[model samples]
Target: MRTRGTGDACATYNQFSLGADYAVSKRTDFYLVAAYQHASGDQRDTNADGTNGGLGEATASIGSYGNQSNTNSQVIVALGIRHRF
Candidate 1:
């Protein structure tokens, strides 16, 4: 699942993921995965602006923060596994 939001001058995006594994044999296994996402409004760096002057800078973009721009996306994949245990 995914979500998105927007505010006066802010926008946000988020994502969540879940995975599960299954055993097909004593030395073989398979896996499955699922994902969800949510988005929040844009974040203003109250500190970065030299206004708040807090420890870390405020969030100018929504979603999570930094590299992950307010507008972000997520994906998940599953694969097979082999073990001797």
Candidate 2:
């Protein structure tokens, strides 16, 4: 199957995130977060020829990500620290 653009693809994705922060001495805070994403249906990914088509087409992902995921699922884990004066 082929699609003219992402609008034609029935691709779908879902994301889940959980995060929390702890204050340390009132000067800074430490944070940790975990996120996961999954894609389903016909994803219109960038094609080799650089066309807006299905798996072998399109130039961008159906979501905010840069490129369409080659796999149906994705996961991300992050940690950070912040301080304000």
Candidate 3:
């Protein structure tokens, strides 16, 4: 969880994540991962001088994907397999 901005123009984010892995053999494995994030409140824009400028809505980005959703919530899921030679 994290927070940014100040007063009524503050943005708060809550995030949760889960992961699991299973070994199928000595050199093979399967894995699954999921993440979710939710944002609340407002986020104000900052001027070059670091002063509050305009008002903006909060958004959610799952983990470090760098893809912020248009809304206030986001979810991501991934499944994969690994093999060794």
Candidate 4:
């Protein structure tokens, strides 16, 4: 899909994600999750004053959140544990 942000440029991306969960007990669980994204099209360049500077290639920022990557593709992986009372 196409998306717009702070400027006139538009960007397109394809993302894939996977997640798994394992229950160790009635009160505990283990989980793992991962995501990959590739961005294309053009993006706006912003100046220090928040003005549109120019247009450039779009970079990947997984889940549309977190820090923007320097390249066109990005990967994210996370593992954790959860417990209940």
Give the top-scoring candidate (TM-score): 4
In model 1, the Cα lDDT at residue 73 comes to 44
TM-score of each: 0.40, 0.64, 0.76, 0.80
Spell out the clash pairs found in candidate 2. 45-57, 47-56, 52-58, 53-57, 53-58
lDDT of each: 0.48, 0.60, 0.85, 0.85
Query: What does the lDDT come to for candidate 2?
Result: 0.60
Report the number of clashing residue pairs per model.
11, 5, 0, 0
- In model 4, where is the ten-residue run with the lowest total lDDT? 1-10
**Alpha-carbon error at 19 in model 3, in Å?**
0.5
Candidate 3, 1-85: lDDT as tens digits: 5655578778888888899999999999999999888898888766999888888888886777888799999999999999999
Q: Rank the candidates by lDDT, best first.
A: 3, 4, 2, 1
Q: Which stretches of candidate 2 lie over 4 Å from their true place?
A: 1-7, 48-50, 55-69
The alpha-carbon lDDT assigned to residue 57 of candidate 1 equals 19
User: What is the RMSD, in Å, between candidate 3 and the native fold over all Cα?
Assistant: 3.5
Candidate 3, residue 73: Cα displacement in angstroms equals 0.4
Write model 1 residue lDDT over 8-79, tens digit each, in one string: 434444556677888888787878776544445444445545774323212323233334333334343546
